[model samples]
Target: MKKAILYLVDEAGVIQGVQLSAELWKKAEKVVLPLLEEPESQELQREGPLKDFQTLMEYWDFTYPYSPRVRCPHCGASCEDWRTDEKHTFILNTANLGGLLVFHCTRCGTTIRHKHFKDHMSIEHTIPAKYKKS
Candidate 1:
């Protein structure tokens, strides 16, 4: 049987998208990234799944197989779809913190943080983002 349905969850730790394997993700990267960065495609506004993919690509730095197994902690939702920048979703990029992948769970309002360790990865912390008072 297949190990797990690969998912690109949203900030809510909810399965927002599905990804079978790194190979498939790579294929998507090739098709999506160029369009977002290409000068000719500037007029095209990226929305829906494309925006989520773009955010993930930017956060992962085009790395493949970010996590062999992606499962939500709160809801235990497997990889489904990648949702981003919605009223209930937000992906915070923490590259400075050792390439941390910070996802805010809009459903439960939980912040899930994961760190990359070579071929494998693990959840490092799950906390709220520190905001500054201006």
Candidate 2:
């Protein structure tokens, strides 16, 4: 019989993860998924700035549709979709009704601003306080 599950190990032979066969995964799905999902009580609270970012999009009045992409000029770190990026590179710092959105870059302590205008968008970034020359 073939191995039902493959144990992915590190160089030191410590099991780092598991790769399951389709048949075996089907059997374990019922038991494993809940363990991975967020707890009920935890889910009740706010999920973070991501929700606020989405709320601001609903109020967007820009000429072009909203784009989820964000970039940090200070550190050259970027996220295609700030909402779903697993790395959490850029964090939503502020979202307001006046068509202004601010993000704080985790990789570099930079503040990025996306200012939406009627015909175009303006991008601005401020270097971290530590990097600011006196």
Candidate 3:
């Protein structure tokens, strides 16, 4: 099925939204479905069937397929949409007994930090300023 992924962008133009394709969706299910079939997972589902992809995406970060391009936080450019290779740096810290996530905007040379990289994407990167304060 044709899927339109939605992206949230900053004024500088970085990716903030995610939509999955039928292929990606199926892939996600492949990973999650097996887990859901497990006795433990089935027990958890006693509350209800897991109904959304976001839950699987959040639970299966390492396996979730991500696109190569990111939005430029300074220029509002859809880096992947334009197929540009401008380097955006991602800092993942799983060392030194400290946890931090950092994203560097290549277009405007801005660095953003968050307690968690995934949180940074879901909360800071994808959210527009207009909606950030709210």
In angstroms, how far off is 74's CA in candidate 2? 0.8
Off by over 4 Å in 3: 1-63, 81-101, 112-134
For model 2, residues 1-134, the per-residue Cα lDDT tens digits are 28989999999999989999999999999999886543212221134565666777777777898888999888788889887888777777777767778887766668899998888889999987678889
The candidate that wins on lDDT is 2
Please give the CA lDDT of all the candidate structures.
0.49, 0.77, 0.40
Winner on lDDT (2 vs 3): 2
C-alpha TM-score for every candidate: 0.35, 0.60, 0.26
Off by over 4 Å in 1: 1-64, 67-70, 77-90, 124-134
1-134: candidate 3 lDDT, tens digit per residue: 55545567879899866667667777787786786543221111111112222343345454334343445454464455222332323322111112233344433434444332433333145433544565
Model 3, position 84: C-alpha lDDT score: 32
Cα error of candidate 1 at position 3, Å: 56
How are the candidates ranked when ordered by lDDT, highest leading?
A: 2, 1, 3
Measured by TM-score, how close is model 3 to the native structure? Answer: 0.26
